[model samples]
Target: MIFYGKQNVNKVDIEAVVSVLQSDFLTQGPAIEKFEQYVAKYCGAKYAVAVTNATSALHIACLAAGLKKGDILWTTPITFTASANCGRYCGADIDFVDIDKKTYNISVEELEEKLINTDVKPKVVVPVHFTGQSCDMEKMYRLAKQYNFKIIEDASHAIGGEYKGHKVGCCEFSDMVVFSFHPVKIVTTGEGGMVLTNNKDLYDKLILYRSHGITRNQDLMTKKSDGPWYYQQIDLGFNYRMTDIQAALGYSQMQRIDEFVTKRRYLVNRYNDLLKDLPLILPYQIDEANSSWHLYVVKIDFNKVNKAKVDIFKEMKNKGVCLNLHYIPVHTQPYYQSLGFKQGDFPNSEAYYKEVFTLPLYYDLSYEEQDYIVQCLKEVLE
Candidate 1:
């Protein structure tokens, strides 16, 4: 069956991991720093901290941003729960901003309006780069400066994307940017993530937060060390370090990022042309942002299509095509609902969840397979 997304691992990726396996250190070694530096240099960021996964990366990023109890963190409800859960990990209150109807990123207009009208203000705003397309971060950055809130771009889907001619992880518009290297993501490190930042202090904090908050550096210690081996626990942090094996794989994957994104874009354009006449809303593109096309999501207009969504899913699966949903509205989840967030709390996200489904998109999806998937979709919808 065709998958909604898949990773492409070549001979070089395997060789990199094998070399690391033959090396001295497997975890917390030179390969990890090498990978970090490679990604930072690629994205034009001053520093990067690699971690176990995107969820842990977000957790450390929120902690480094000074999020704490009673403080509010706002993000769109249309993302994976990690986007909001990271804030909660810091003991902060979680609130959601509804997504824009067109771009499906956090709405800068609604955010500003909410800022003006709401009594409580967010300490940090996480704008998710949904479907690998960046939000209007320049405008979001302007609002952040005016309102005194920190912006941590949840760029899990946007590693190879660009905004206004700059790379997405450059940290030009936000304080920090996070990237995911899950198997199905644009790049694969088996399971890895990175947090990129330009600020030295935040970088230091993120470094401490990724590894039990222990510091071997003498300058950060409260008192002088007894010997060279001495260290201290500077802050409460977690074990989120990425292994050398993963980093080696990631460093190798970084070399082919452009190739991966280009192929995905080619597939996306083909989908745009082939599926244009269907009763479906293809992914939209804005002028300021060029997407990596990590996902090719289409919204079915139930009004025009006679079949129910579940029936369509079954039919497509039977025909050897596998479609998937990007998300269920985070606030409508039982845990968030228990936090007093009811069904109608965020109308736009709930509405979006009802119709959207991800189509097959990846580096190695061939034209023949894509045509077959599109044909399956057409048969189900028509």
Candidate 2:
């Protein structure tokens, strides 16, 4: 069956890993820094700290931003729990802002309204770049400056995407941008993530926490520290380092970054062309941003469709069109409900969760597979 997303790996990817295995440095070495530099330069960020996964990267990034108990963090309700869980990992009180129906991203207008009436203002606003389309960064940044809150862009789905001509990870309009290089993402490091930032202070903090808060820098070492080889634990931290093997894989994948994004866009265009008039509402990419098209989600019109959404999904699956759901409203989950978030707290997110389904979207999904999926969708809906 055609899965919703799949990784595009070739000889180059495997060869890169083999080369790393043949080398002396397998964990901490030149390859890691090489991959980091490649990503930093590509995204126009001053620094990129590689971690084991995006969740770890998010954790370190939030901690570096000074999030802690009593501090509030806000994010969109319609996203992977990792977006909000990162805040909770730092003991920050998590809150949700509803999503806009069109882009399925955090609504800037709703965010502004919430801020106007909020009692304890958020210390950080983590706007998720859902489906590789950016949130309203201009409006969000202006509000962040006014409200004295930091911005952590949850760009896990948008490494190669762009907003207003700037690359998503540039961090020009936010405190930092986080990326996930999972198997399904545009670039793959098997299971890895990176945190990009322009601020040296935040960069230093991220680096600090990423590797057990240990520092060998003489400037940061204890005043009476022993020898040149001595190190000190400056603060609380974690073991979130990415290995040289993963970095080598990431570095190789970086070469095809543009190719991967271009192929996904082509596939999305094909799907749109074939199914735009069908019994569904296709994803809407913002005109101001160049979306990476990480997901091709469509909302089924239950009233017009012949069968129940579940039956339609099952039929598609049987036909080898492995459709999936992009998300469930995080606030509606059992854990979030226990946190006091009820069913109707975010109307748009709840509505989105009810009807949306993800179609096959990835670089390796060929034109033939897309055609088959579209034909199967048409058959199922009819």
Candidate 3:
């Protein structure tokens, strides 16, 4: 059956990991730094911290940003729970901004309105790059400056995407940017993530937060070192370090990022062209952002289509297609609802969740396979 997403791993990726296995250090070693440097340079950022996963990257980023109890952290409701859970990990109150109907990212207009009217402003606002398309970060950044809130871009779907001619992880528009390297993401490190930042202080904090908050550097220590072996646990942190094996694979994957993005974009165009006549709302592109097309999601106009959403999924599955939903609004989840986020809290996001679904789009998806997917979709809709 055709899956919604898949990783593209070549011989080079395998060889890189195999070589790291033969090396002296497998966890905290040269491979990690090398991979970090490559990602930083590619994204035009000053520093990149590799971690175990995107969730951990977001966790450390929130901690480094001084998110604590009673502070507010805001993100779009139409995202993976990890986007909101990261704030909860810091004991911060998690709130959600509604999504833009077209872009499916956080509604910048709503965010500014909320900022202007609310008594409590967010300590940090995480704008997710949904479906690899960046939100209107320039406007978001302007609002942030005016309101005195930090911006942490949850760019898990957008490693190679560009906004206003700058790379997404450049930190030109946000304080920090996070990337995921899961098997189904734009790149694969088996399972890894990275946080990129331009501020030296934030970079230092992220480094400390990723590895038990311990530091061997004498400058950061409270007292002078007793010996070369002396270290200090300066703050509470987690063991979120990325292993050399994962880093090596990530470095190799970095070499082919452009190729991967180009292939995905090509397939996205194909899907857009083939599915144009169907009763679906195709992905929309904003003029300022060039998406990486990590996911090719379309909204079914159920008013025009006779089938229920579940029945469409069932029919597609029976026909060997495995379509998937990108998200359910985070506020509607039981945990968030118990936190007092009830239905009708975010109308646009809840409306979006009912109609949108992801189509297969990945680096290795061939034209023939894509045509078959379109055919299956056409049959189901017809």
Candidate 4:
């Protein structure tokens, strides 16, 4: 069966994990720092803090940005719930701006319109880079400066993507950026995440937030805390620290990120050519930006054919092709519905959800397998 996403593990990756298992420090160790340094250097960011997963990274980012109860946090509805749930973790009110039909990212025009007219001032904006395509960061940065809102880029699908010819996590256009290291990402650490930022204060806060807020910082204590054995819980935090074993795998995976991204791009080009003549709409490129091609999503022509998305989905599954949907609109979730969100609020997101399906596109997917997938899709569609 062809999977929509997968990890490319090698003997070297296995050996890296084995070495970590035989090492002295398993949790908080030098390997974790090494992994953080590797990602930070790759992204050209000043600091990178490793966490248990991308959700935890997002949570810390929101907390460090001072999101609190009654504060508004805005993002695109077409993303994983973690994108908006992180704000709710900090007790902040969460809302969403509709997405652009072409880019599948938040619309800057809609964002500006909401900010200009809404009674509730937003404390932060978390723009998700869906399918590894970056949002319009320069425009978002300008809006941030004007509206006095912070930015936490949920770059879970975009660690290797470039914005304006620079790494996405350099924070050139946002306050902070978060990355995922799940097995299906560009690189794998089993399960891990990182937070990148240039501001030292936010960096320090991220460190504290990842580990129960218990800090040994001498300067942060209320009183002159004791020597060599001083620590305090300044604010509430979580046990979100990443393990050294996971970090070791991440460090090894970092070496091949460029190669992985290159291969994904090649495969996407192949798909674009093979499926161009089909009754489907292909994903449009984000202008002037380089994507990592995390998922190859195409919109089926439900209007052209009598077959709805569900029929095609069931046929693909029955044929042993594990094609998957990227996501449903986060605002439509039952949990979010209690927050007063209703259908028809974000038409573009709903439309994307109805027709979009991710094809089998991963680093390890072979050329022959792809041809078979295309052939099968043609048989099903035609």
* Candidate 2 wrongly placed segments (more than 4 Å): none
For candidate 1, write residues 170-235 as lDDT tens digits.
999999999999999999999999999999999999999998999998989999999988999989
Lowest-sum lDDT 10-residue window in model 4: 301-310
Q: Per-residue lDDT of 1-382 in model 3, one digit per residue for the tens?
A: 9899999899989999999999999999999999999999999999999999999999999999999999999999988999999999999999999999899999999999999899999999999999999999999999999999999999999999999998889999999999999999999998999999999999999999999999997889999999988999999989999999999999999999999998888888888889999999999999999999888889999888999999999999998889999899999999999999999999999999899899988887889989998998888998
Residues 205-269 of candidate 2: C-alpha lDDT, one tens digit per residue: 99899999998877777676698778999898999999999999999999999998988888888
lDDT of candidate 4 over 1-382, digit per residue (tens): 7889999888888899889899999999999999999899999999999999999999999999999998989999989999999999988899999999888889999999999999887899999999998999999899999999999999999988999999878899999999999999998888989999999999999999999998988877888887787789998989999998999899988999999999999999999999998888999987767999888899988767678778888888888888889889999999999999999989999988998899988999999999888888887897
Error of 1 at 380 (Å): 0.9
Instruction: Between candidates 1 and 3, name the one with more favorable lDDT.
Output: 3
RMSD per candidate (Å) reads 0.7, 0.9, 0.6, 1.0
TM-score of 2: 0.98
In order of lDDT, best first, we have 3, 1, 4, 2
Model 3 misplaced regions, further than 4 Å:
none
Off by over 4 Å in 1: none
Best by lDDT: 3
Candidate 3: count of backbone clashes, pairs at least 3 residues apart or interchain: 0
Clashing pairs in 1: none
Cα lDDT, all candidates: 0.94, 0.91, 0.94, 0.91
